[model samples]
Target: MEDRDWLILKTIYEEKNMSKAAQVLHVSQPALTYRLQQLETEFNTKIVHRSNKGVEFTGQGEYLAKYAVDMLNKLRMTKEIVESMENKVQGTLRLGVSRNFARYNLPPLLSNFLTKYPDIKFHLITGFSSEITDLVYKEEFHIGIIRGNNNWKEQKLLLAQEPVCIVSKSEIDSNSLPALPRIHYETEPSLQSVINNWWEENFTQPPFITMRVDRIDTCKEMVKNGLGYAIVPKACLTEDDILYQINLTTRDQKEILRDTWVIYRNSSLELTMIRAFIDFIKSIKQEGV
Candidate 1:
């Protein structure tokens, strides 16, 4: 089958509905149907069974979808290889980045990189660290930048380390933190556990949580408004903000820190674009950005 046919099949398999796939592929429903019919006729097998709810792939369809995905990946790699022979790093850099990092940090970094390599394009996917890690592991992204730690066995580099601190609108006695109306936010499990363990070690009583928010930025805003106190990574705090901050530490007095990491498969470094991107990130890290 042709490359376009593989793309159509892959899109259909992902969307699981002809109408949605047609919309994504920028093709009319009738045209998409005609193409599917042609494929079925050529292969002499039913690819998908239609229903009111959606379409379901038959066994042969499922196998063909997998084949299509492999073929597409090979084609992409081959294209990158051919382009790299010209000593040009011009291709899409697929990135999966943590939502918090994407919001707070990625803009300037990406802007600088783009300014330097105007030919390179980016496809960024923002999600939770766990989701980003999964995407990187699946090779869906050339690289992933995530907060906190993960069990990925890929090539990983520590991008940055920032202090995790307790922040409030005003200074308060250290002993009173356990009784204060603490603001909490949802974060990666590893970071949550670190905060919880720190609290457990410092005080016998649990935190008097006043509110729970979905994101760290919201938690910081609530603290900024004098609603309550929050413990967050240093990146959430601005240098000019007139807020009370207390850097946290383990019971042994080691700093409690949040780490940002760039993860990729070792084999992916062979691509000139991926290698250049990784080196760019390293340069950014060295510059303490």
Candidate 2:
């Protein structure tokens, strides 16, 4: 099949919906269907089957899709290598970052880096730190900016650390936390583990959870309205937030912190854009951004 067919397979596999894939590829649904039919006829096989939700791939289709994704990755790598050979730091820098870092830290850092290297482009994917970790392992991106110290044996630089803290609308006795209403939210497992461990350290009883929310911001709002207290990262709070916070501490009297890391494989450094961005990040760290 041609490059476009490979892209079609990859996009269809990723999107899991024919219409969505068509929209993403900027092609009509009928056109996409026709192309798939052509591919099936050429290969003398049925690739995908219609399902209630979207579509499901046959085993042969799955193999072809996997090959397509690998091919696309190799193609991008080829482009990166070719661009590196030029005396310019220009190419799409594929990055996977945690949603928290993307929301709070990435914009200014991207701004400054782009100011210096105007030709460097970005293909960023942001999700939970856990998801980013899996993406990193899949080698879909050159770099991953993630929160928490995860199981990465490859090269990683500690970017920053934020204190883990408890927040409420008003000050309350530390000893009374177990009895007070607590707001719980869904977050990465690592952060949840840290909070759970800290809770176990200071309290003999379970938290009196008043409400469960889906996001950190929702928990923050619940705390702001005096509904309950929540354990969260200090980076989630702003100066304008009129909430009382107590930083969690370990038994050794050290503050509990959530660390952000810039993770990348050493082999990626062969690309000029990768090296340039790494250097830019090092400068940012040194200058205290």
Candidate 3:
């Protein structure tokens, strides 16, 4: 089938509703229906079945959608490689970045990188480090910027390391932390495990968790209001936050540092845009916590 037909099937598969797929494709519903009918007729199979709930893909439809995804990816990769052959570094750069790094570091990093290579276009997806790593492994991203120690077996560069600290409205004794009211926030499982293990090693008593929140910033606000204390990475705190922050250390006295890494398959460096961006990443000097 043609690229247009492939895209049609893919979009319908993603959107799951005829009307939603049509809107995304920027085509009329009737036209979309006609196109799908033509595709099904050419294949001589029932591709998708529509019911009152939504559209459901048949076995053939599922196979076609998977084929469409692979073909689209191959075509996109070919375009990137061809665009990179020129002297000008201009091509689409797909990236998957961790949430904290995307929030604190990526904007300025991308701004400067774009200034140097004005023709380069960026497609960035921000998520948990674990999710980013999975996307990278699936070849959905040219590069991934992630946090903690992700087990990426290919090219990996340590971007920065920031201290993990406890913040509160007022200074509290380090030994008193377990007895203090703790503001708990959800974080990636890897990092959460690290924090939990550290707590277990350092204290005999459990933390007196007073409240639970979904985000680090929400935990910070709770701390600012003198509600409780939170343990967060240095990236979450600012100089003007007006809070007391105590850096954590290992039992042997080394600071507990949270690491950020840039990960990619080595083959990606063959592209001019990817190569240039990696070189640029190497040159930047990130200030420490």
Candidate 4:
């Protein structure tokens, strides 16, 4: 099949619905259906089936979809290579970033980068650090920015190391932390584990959690309103917030730090765009942003 056919299969697999795939592919529903029928006929088997949820791919369809994804990635790489031969650093930079970073840090960083390399396009996906790391590992993204550590063998660079702290609306005794109202927010599992471990190390009793929120910003607002205290990375704090902040430390008296990392496969650096982008990020860190 042609590259267009591969793209159609890949889009169908990703969208999981004929109409949605049609919209993404910028084709009519009838045209997409005809294309799928043609693919099925060419393969001499049913490619997909309708389900209550949406379209479900058969085993053969799944295999073809995987192949289609590989083909698309290779095609993209080839194009990038050809373009780079002319000494141009321009291409789509697919990046997966943590939600917190996306909300707070990414805008300025992207603004500066895009200003410098106007030809470079960005496709950003934001989620939990764990989810972003998975996307990077799956080669779905050329780069990933995540909070916390990874056990993967891919190349990783430390972007920043900020302290985790006890934040509250009013001054609270660190010695009596377990007795006070605690505000917990759902975050990356690794971060939560670090906070839990720190708590377990210092206190015999569990925290008196007053509220549980889904977002870090919400947790910060709750603490700012005198609701409770939360243990979060320092990225949540700003100079404008007049909150009581107590930096955390381990039992051995080392600072409790939260790290943000830039991760990518070494092989991906072959693309001039990715290489330039990585260098740009490193330069920003060097300039102490």
Give the range where candidate 1 is weakest over 10 consecutive residues by summed lDDT.
233-242
Candidate 3, 241: how far from true, in Å? 1.7
List candidate 1 segments past 4 Å from native.
none
Each candidate: what lDDT? 0.89, 0.90, 0.89, 0.90
On residues 1-289, what C-alpha lDDT tens digit does candidate 3 reach at each position?
Answer: 8999889999999999999999999999999999999999999999999998889999999999989988888888888888888857998899999997898778989999999999999998999999999888878799999999877899998989889998999989989988889999988787788789889999999999989999888888899999999899998787768999888889999999999999998878879999999888888844332
TM-score of each: 0.91, 0.94, 0.94, 0.94
lDDT of 2 at 42: 91
Residue 98 shift from truth in candidate 1, angstroms = 1.3
lDDT of 2 by residue, 94-189 (tens): 899988788777898899899999998899999988888777777788999999869898989999999999899999987899899998998878
* Candidate 1 lDDT by residue in tens digits, 8-61: 999999999999999999999999999999999999999999999989999999
How many clashes does each candidate structure show, in the order listed?
0, 0, 0, 0
In model 3, the runs with Cα more than 4 Å from the true position are: 285-289
Please say which candidate is ahead in TM-score: 1 or 4. Answer: 4
